[model samples]
Target chain A: MIELKNVTKQYPGQPHPAVDSLTLTVPEGEICVLVGPSGCGKSTTLRMINRMIEPSAGSITINGQSVMNNDPDHLRMGIGYVIQQIGLLPHRTIAENIAIVPRLYKWPKEKIVRRVDELLVMMGLDPEKTRSKYPSQLSGGQMQRVGVARAMAVDPPIMLMDEPFGAVDPIARTHLQDEFLRLQKEIRKTIVFVTHDINEAIKMGDKIAIFGEGKLVQFGTPEEVLTNPANEFVENFIGYDRIVKKLFLYQVQEAYRPAVCRLRPEEIGNALSKMLAEKAEVAFVLNEADKPCGYLTREELEQEETARDADGLQKLAARRSKAFVQTTTPLPDALSVMLEYDAEYVGVLKNGLLEGVMSFKDIRRHVYRREGE
Target chain B: MKMSWERFQIALFEKAPEAVLTHLLIVVITVALAILISVPLGVLLTRPRYRKFGVVALNILNILNAIPGMAVIALALPILGLGIKPAVVALLFQSLLPIVRNTIAGLLEVSADVKEAAAGMGMNQRQILLEVEMPLAMPIILSGIRTSTVYVVSVGTLAALIGAGGLGNMIIGGLALFMPEYLIVGAGLGAIMSIFFDRALSYLEYKITPPGVRAN
Candidate 1:
């Protein structure tokens, strides 16, 4: 655990402290994202944890030991740090960059080499192809991945990441964020993430600490902060789209309703009867093993008057790739899949088996019910 | 013309071979000493507390640089009392400005992000300076050394004025005796040496520059 007690950082001439007397505790194996507008001392607080920026007053302890007791270099070596610019040493190849800490710790040569290749693979880069390439040779996304890989080279238990994905284009940023999230699930390192983008905070933070000026205005789980903002500033910071943003925090499985009308590809008459009796808009067509094969809309079913036709509902079903969403997909993504395919609903699948289906109506109802409460 | 060529060969191979050797020796020693003194002095000036002192030191060196090489040698003559010693000292002072100024400039040109990353990654101040800052600043610093080397070689000719044996002796002696061959041999060899040293250092600069930062 990382704990700060009444930490304050006051510049010599500045009237207000850059970071006021603030205290925060980050539990083991959790990500605490520090977020606010520019110059709110979010970065200051992060630097203080590693002793890069010493606080004027108060104590900081990592893993229950006072940070002051350790040498700054020794302390820093034990913590991973990544920044916005992805500061990989331009002169060094990707492998050398990743080997920095491990080499610093005086690991055996083979061990360092092994770790470098391991981290490259972990960051989704092909080690043999990338190990010898310099930072300048890589794209912005690749450089950012290498930056993260370098930070994790020594497997430091705590990581301090300051807007690590801020420099990439939106498409690459999303890709990097997904890869990092997947990597984080496996590593489970205690991380202190700093970002100003609220959506990013909601997406990656296990708990978000909202800062205003030099003080933390609110610190809570994304659900708590979104559902019950501490004050007007936080509410304003979260913006008017908080309701919709909350949907990103929920998975498709959480809001999906069991399909009322599901039918095998051959059972066209039964499919039509179920759609009619249930007044459903779409009927999911299943294959022999009960996996979602395609879907048929009531409009298409009505046009096909002959239910006993050889092709039956199978021919009428639209096998759109966008119609499929996994159970683990966030509701916002599921909604986007619906919009992308121009479909009324999306099938939620687990291991190729149809668990249920979700529509905009289901997400809206779920979000609205939470809002009402 | 044939007589001048015969005289030039005799002057270069027999009469003044020692002058040529001494001239090369003086240039090498002066440049080596200038590099040893100025590179560290340049690095020292870049430190935050010493930065102002560095500016003041550079200004003093700039004044020294502005002075004519002959005048600097003349000034050194009275204090050190002549020969290769005072001449070497004057040339050393003359070369200081380029190496010092270029070292400071090269170090300063390193991006703030690179330094922060070095520190954040647990590199101490010395490691950051050596492994990160120095390697990045090398191309610029080597350029400075090249300039200093050329200056030292050209100025070493002036050491002959204070009874220092160099190619300058031939030029001075040839003018007095009206021997055009002596002048050509001295001036010709000096120019060739300057070009040779400059090219060598330029090659060094190219080789030491990090591949990622090498100009296209």
Candidate 2:
């Protein structure tokens, strides 16, 4: 747990601290988003933790140990950081960029190389394609991936990302945000993410801390922050669309299976028959034991048949080729996957096995429930 | 007896195929040396605690820069004793201020946000300086170097007054000898090098320096 006990920061001759005696704690394994308008001290509050900006008053403790007592270098090595511009070293290759923290900690050369390669792949980059490429050659979205890769290089327990997705275009930004959320699930790192976007805060934050003019105006879950705004500033910051925003959060879950659907070789015929009988046109193909397989349409089978020799067609066998989700995956993500694959449903899996299927129909039903409440 | 201006002029151009090369060499050497020395100093001076001291140092350097070239050469004559060293020393000192001052201005011109982004990414001070700050400051530094080069070319003519050999010695020779061609060659070469050099350095500066590091 990271705790900031009434931390404050005042520039010399300033009338008030940029962060004013604000107190907060971010529990382990949670995403705590700090957000506010420009100059509200959210950024200052974030920077103060790393001692990039010193707090004028109050104390900061990481897992109950005072950060002030430790060398700032040691304190920073254990924390991951990402920034708005994605702060990549322009001259360095993606691998070397991610290796910075490990190199700083004097990790062995082979270990640094191994860690860099693993993180590159974990951040969804192909090490072969990206490892040697300099920062300038990558797009905004790719740069953010490298930044996230760099942050995760040392496997720090805490990650600090300051508007990491802000530089990318909207489509890329949304995609990156989803990828970031996915990474958080896999890593389960305690994250302190700062942003000014309410939608992002609602989507990613387990807890939201809203700031107003150097003071923390509200601190609560997204539901509480949006539905029960602490004051006029927070209400205004959250805007009048709080109802719709809240609805989007829970509505996606309703649209379908938030679990992985997989089909094995033996179940392929049965799954295909179900789609044909229901006239669903497209069905998710789950493997025999039930896991996410790719979407299949009768048209795909016909195309394959026409392309093959008659003898080959007679010998053709059915197999489930795709696996998709784990339960607890966000609705927005699952829905997008369904939409992208042009399927009516997706498979939900828990652990390595398939649990159930979620259809668009099921998702609508969930949305209806949220609306009624 | 004093040597005739004709022979004095020969010492100036002794190594030159044409007398003009003596003046060209003096101007070129002075500007090059100034650039080599001042840009780093200028960049170093703009740092936090050093800013005020940097400004004051620049002011003093500028005062030195403004001293009459002939007077500088004359002042150096006693210690440097009537040769290329005194002439080159005077011109180099005079050329330093503009290049150094402009280098500082250029470096300070980089956006603060860019610097902060570099720092927050776990870059130590040296990394930020060598990687981000210096690259951004290069264009401005080059401009300073160019400005000083042009100034030093014009000042090289004054070196001849103190018996420090250069094309200026030929101009002085002609003035004493009433030989118009020698004066024309010396003065013409100095003027030509000044214009040619400013353009050349400006071109090199533009061609080589990148717009900026992608802090975005």
Best by TM-score: 1
Candidate 1, residues A331-360, lDDT tens digits: the string is 888888888888888888888887887878
How high a TM-score does candidate 1 get?
0.95
Q: Give DockQ per model, in order.
A: 0.77, 0.20
- Candidate 1 on B1-216: residue-level lDDT in tens? 335677878888886778778988898889899989999999999988799898689899999999999998888888988788888998898998999999999999998988888788898889889988999998999999999999888888888888787988888888888888888888888898899999999999999988888877
Each candidate: RMSD to true structure? 2.2, 8.2
Off by over 4 Å in 1: A275-282, A288-290, A297-316, A319-322, B1-3
Interface C-alpha root-mean-square deviation of candidate 1: 0.7
Query: Model 1: which residue pairs collide?
Result: none
Which lDDT values do the candidates have, in the order given? 0.88, 0.75
